[model samples]
Target: MGKKSATVVLAHGAWADTSSWGKVVVLLQSDGINAVTFRLPLTSLADDVTALDKVLALVDGPVVLVGHAYAGAVIAATHSAKVRALVYIAGLAPDQGETVADVFNRYEHDEKAPKLAPGDDGLMWLAPEAFGIAFAQHASPEEQKALAAKQLPISPAAITVPVERPLWKDVPAWYLLAQHDHMIPEKTQRFMAERMNAHISAYPVDHLPSVTAPELVATVIVDAVRFVDG
Candidate 1:
């Protein structure tokens, strides 16, 4: 990809901040693809999308939005005309009238996956131990620890709210399926990808491929960028 190609804006999922995309950003930068990441307020879907819209407004050219986990829904809700393509990495793509919780709870839960509920704080928190187990089992123990420590609690309102017309319906999209993901089951990923008819790339990775397998994540995003900017 060229330096002036469609810039990639990586969006972090629930329980994560912008740092999750650091490694992927570095890899994309090495390829002369301008990749940037922004923080999503986990307060609510509207809040997160507004934050992403503000960031999208700052960029100067076409964009390929890459979202992981819950950010998938956040990215697809954008009204930005500059977004040409979308890349969903182990993401949750809830259709119009469907909430993130709808997609998440549609399939049977993996035994290792942590059961989630809003805590007394009114935000959903992933247990630190669950991070090493289901969130990123493929990641190194040290990496898992860091991920757990760096998470931002996602508000219950974020996932329970229904999304508007998803941009994926209008834009070309790509999906990276994490085959071994315990958090969001592989079947669900496949269902969402096929529903969107997105170009699919499957890997024997976990949910947090941006952290555990940055190279793989970056490759799929670069593919989207090439297609959109070609």
Candidate 2:
């Protein structure tokens, strides 16, 4: 593996903020990789992509853009030449003409998944009990509480927006499949990763592996950085 020199920009998914990548950031920096996390507003797809692009603009040299869940679509929307590679951590990767919702609803819904509902403001939020049962079953009681408290509501229109061109089509990509994910089915994840022809690392972790298994998440990201650096 090559030494760490590239910037690793992490994009968090829906119902999450930049703090979601906290542990992973620490690990990456400890390994001497320039790591930064982007905060998505969860308002609209275009808005999120613009936020990611701004972060990419400030980064120097080669970058390995990492996205978790919904942020996958955000990272894929970028056409930045500075981004040499892409990494998906149980992320959603939609193709041209297909909306994030289209790919998300492609498979049979998991029975254990949370019942999501939108508020009058057109924002969607997971049920309070969802944090422990569906979203992050492997997380501790305290960790789950923290996650629930910090949850960011997502706009319904964000998922409905279609992706024009996914950056994964041009950049080398890697995927870390969460086998125990309830938010996104494991089969759906595999299908998308295979379609993108991404180098995949399957793990027996839940949806929030970056929190429940930071070591594994950081390892996969570091490996992708090494590949890009080489």
Candidate 3:
């Protein structure tokens, strides 16, 4: 077998903590791959970017920066030259001039998602009831409850703030489109992937495939590593 490849630093989505990637991390490590998950502060976009930057700096060699869900904006906004590739997993890959809010507004999605209202602390989060349907439909009931308990509230200001620099434009990109995702419509994902000119793969899964379908997610990530190596 070829030598073990570069380290992978995986970032989680809006409501999730680094534990969201638990299964994927286990699978990657079983193969002797070096991987780490960044525990994003889920505060402001700038703070999230800073956390990812710290993770990138810790990588010993070339790195494949992986982002899930909202973290696509996070990774693209704060990448370093040491990153060899990017893999967006059922995530939003916005451009430098675009904001996650702009991307969401452009797409006409079902409004079933719980209305997000800003909190006293200026952070926004999913309504407790919306968690089961919108965010954890694919996970087991226990998993859903666990995720709900640990969900982090983010600042609403972070959503509309466009990325200052999107790595998608500067680095090679791979997108894993979750076909069964109810949160991010497949149609919108296609549009974003096309706009970004990414190499795309389709998966018949929900938004958190890295949690519910770890093996499949790991394979997609491994494929991206191979593509970058070539």
Which candidate leads in TM-score? Answer: 1
Give the Cα error of residue 34 in candidate 2, in Å.
Answer: 0.9
Sort the predicted structures by TM-score, highest score first.
1, 2, 3
* TM-score of each prediction: 0.97, 0.97, 0.93
Clashes of each: 0, 0, 0
Q: Quote the RMSD, in angstroms, for model 1.
A: 1.6
For residues 1-230, write the lDDT of model 1, one tens digit per residue. Answer: 45467989999998878888999999999998998888888899999999999999999889999999999999999999999999999999999999999999888978999989889988899999998899988889998888899999999899988888999999999999999999999999999999999999999999999989999999999899889878
> Which 10-residue span in candidate 3 carries the lowest summed lDDT?
105-114
Candidate 3: TM-score?
A: 0.93
lDDT of each: 0.92, 0.91, 0.82
In model 3, the runs with Cα more than 4 Å from the true position are 1-4
User: Which of the two, 2 or 3, has more TM-score?
Assistant: 2
lDDT of 2 by residue, 1-230 (tens): 55447899999998777888999999999998989886799999988888988998998789999999998898999889989899999999999989999988889878898877798877998776798988889999998888888999999889998889899999889999999999999999999999999999999999999999999999989998998888
